[model samples]
Target: MAVIPVAIAGAPYEVRIEAGLLARAGEHCRPFLRKNRVAIVTDENVAAEWQAPVTASFDAVGIASDWLILPPGESTKGWEQLARVVDWLLALEVERKDNIVALGGGVIGDLTGFAASMVKRGCGFIQIPTTLLAQVDSSVGGKTAINTPAGKNLVGAFHQPSLVLADPLALDTLPLRDTRAGYAEVVKYGLIDDAPFFEWCEANGAKLLAGDSAARETAIAKSVAAKARIVAADEKETAGIRALLNLGHTFGHALEAETGFSDRLLHGEGVALGMVLAARFSARQGLMSGQDAGRIVAHMEAVGLPSSLKALGLDCSGRRLSDHMLHDKKMDAGTLPFLLLRGIGETFLAKDVDLNEVAAFLDEELRG
Candidate 1:
């Protein structure tokens, strides 16, 4: 097992990644399971394949577990679904000291963590992220949130988990599309700050996707560690240091909004395409070389990820897409901040950007 510590300002946590870690979640969580009643929140898809092993692990540790299964998709991260989860926790009579275990992907982790944060003022929660996307990105950071009709993650909180148990073995059951989509986030870690890691991905990512255990472990550990360092420096996103972590999120979230946050475009898939766009646009602005942007797109395509909006089958013009970004949370005083790159592994937030120019550039990409 590879353990990475996520050292936030006041709330330091750890993420344990390993093959077959799901079967040992009880043992891993034993230190934090102070209460008898544990709430396991998962979506139907994950519950069908992974619930038994997790439940058995808890049972072996002599803990009583109750589950709340949600529908599988980004749609589950909404007011109604959040309320349902909170109500279920209430029905289970979970106390503030008891734990809520998030047992699915980013949706489950975000919703469950938000629910745990709200109930009884603040409750303890553990993240058992079953998807590669969550394992590397969403599951480590405390940025728990649900999407609103207006935009993605419009409603949420900073509720850090007590612990995160990432079982890479669970990823074996994930669809290839999902696996490829998750790789977008793994690549984001390198793009944000680690040039060597970015180069490593350019070489080893294909092997990682091919089920090479060594490559998978290294990718997960490095990605988690990169996020851990950022969260430690800026836990609440008050400092722009953490905002750099949103390398592709602003554009990606806008794309997600344009799709109505539906399955038509998975969050990771949007980020994959968004990162490519971010690099290309940065190069267009003379912030980076166009050749670097081409390299990024080439790597993404090699991994079977969507490197362009055209690949997503979205027909909207770039002006329409820019309109969606207006609702992004990164907007300050009507000016949206973008994490543009100087080159690979070097991204900085550009606050004085012109949305009209962005729209025109996006229009070019859409038409190209």
Candidate 2:
């Protein structure tokens, strides 16, 4: 097992990565099991594959647990589901000290963490992220949120998990498409600040996606370590240091909103294409060399992830897509900051971005 410790000021935590880690989750979480019981929240799809092992782990350790499984999809991250989760936690009579186990993907972790944040003022929770996207990205950050009509993740909080167990074994059950989607995030860490890692990804990403254990473990560990260092530096994103993590999210979330947040474009897929957009847009603005932008797109295409907006076959116009971007959560003082890259490993927030120019760029992309 590889342990990466996240050093947030108020709530430090550890993200553990290993094979078959799900079966020993209770062992890792024994120290934080405050009330001798845990309340688990997951999605229906994960319930069949992961819920049993997790519950059995707790049972073996003499820690009791109850579960509430919600429907699995992007649509489930909204007001209705949030209300249901909170009510169920109330029914479970979860106390402030008890840990709420989020036993699924990003959606489950976000919802469960948000619920724990609100219930009884604030309760502790553990993140047992099953998907690659969740493990490398969402599972570590304290960013918990539910999608709102206004935009994705517009309603949420920064409630860090007490512990995060990223079982690469859990990814064995993921669909190939989901696996590819998750790879976008793993690539993101490299694009943010690690050129050598991006070079390593160019070499080994195929093997990692092919279910090579060593490759997967190395990628997850590096991604988590990068994230932990950044979180420790800027926990709440009050400083712009942590904003680099949003390398692909701004454009990605806009794509998701345009697609109605449906299966047509998974969050990771949107991000994959979004990263391409960010890279190309930077090149367009003369911030980066066109060669670098082409290389980024080539890497994503080679990995079977989306690399262009034109190929996504959306019904919305560029102006319509821009309207969606206007609702992104990263808006600051009425000006949306765009995470643009100057090179493969150099990402910086451009606060003076012109949305009109962004609309025009989307128009060109849509025209293609």
Candidate 3:
């Protein structure tokens, strides 16, 4: 097992990554399992595959377990589901000290963490992420949120988990497309600040996706380490350094919004295409070389991820995509800060950017 430490402001924790780690969750989380009652939040799909092993693990530790399974999808991250989870926890009589186990993917982790943050002032929680996206990105950070009708992650909190138990074996049951989609974020870390890692990804990522155990472990460990370093430096995203983590998120989220946050465009797919656009936009502004933009697109295509809006079969022009950006949470005082690139492994936030020009750029891309 590889352990990566995430140092947040008030609370610091470690992310434990290994194949078959789920069977040892109770042992890994022994310190936090003070109360005998444990509430597990998961989706139906995950419960069907992982519930038995996790329950047996708890049983070994003599802890009683109760489960709340929500339907799997972005649509489930709403007030209705949040209310149901909260009520379920209440029905279980969960105490502030008893820990809630988030036993599925990002959606489950976000919703359950938000619920733990709200009910009766707050409670303990652990993240047992099943998906590659959740393991490398969402599960480690304290940014838990549920999607609102207005936009993605509009309602949420910084409820850091007491522990994060990531079992890569859970990913075995994931669809191949889902696995490849999650690799987009894994590649994001390399794009932001590590050129060498980016090159390594271009070479070994295919093997990792092909189920090479060594390759998978290396990718997860490296990605987690990079995220941990960033979180430790800027836990609350107050410093611009942390915003680099949003390298592809701004444009990606807009794409998600345009697609109605459906499976049509997975979050990772949006990020993959967004990173390509960020590179192209930077090159257009003379901030980066066109060669770098081409390289970005090539790498994304190599991984079977989307590199352009057109590639996703979306007929909307860049202007239409820009319209979706108007609702982005990053917009402040009517100005949106964009993370643009100067080269591979080099990105800087452009706070003075004009959205009108961005719209024009998108228009140009669409027309071409």
Highest lDDT against the true fold, candidate: 2
lDDT of 3 by residue, 1-368 (tens): 89888878678888989898998877777779877768899999999998899888888888878888889988888999999999999888888888899998889989999999988899989999999899888887788898887889887888889999988888889998888888998999989999999999999989988888888888889998999999889877878788898888888998898899999999888898889889998999999999989988998888799886665666787777887877777777887889999899998889988777888887776665
Runs off by more than 4 Å, candidate 3: none
Clashes of each: 0, 0, 0
| Model 1 spans with C-alpha error above 4 angstroms | none
lDDT of 1 by residue, 248-315 (tens): 88889888888888787888988988899999999999999988899899999888888876666678
lDDT of 2 by residue, 1-368 (tens): 89999989878989999998999988888888877788889999999897788888998898988889999998899999999999999998888888888988899999999999999999999999999999999999799999988889999999999999998988899999999999999999999999999999999999999999999999999999999999899988989999999888888998998888999999999999999999989999999999999999999999999987899888777778878888888777888889999999999999988888888898899778
What's the CA error at residue 304 for candidate 2, in Å? 0.5
- Relative to the true structure, how large is the alpha-carbon lDDT of every model? 0.89, 0.91, 0.87
Model 1 lDDT at residue 106: 92
Q: Against the correct fold, how does model 2 do in TM-score? A: 0.98
RMSD of 3: 1.2
lDDT of 3 at 261: 97
- Would you list the rank order by TM-score, best first? 2, 1, 3
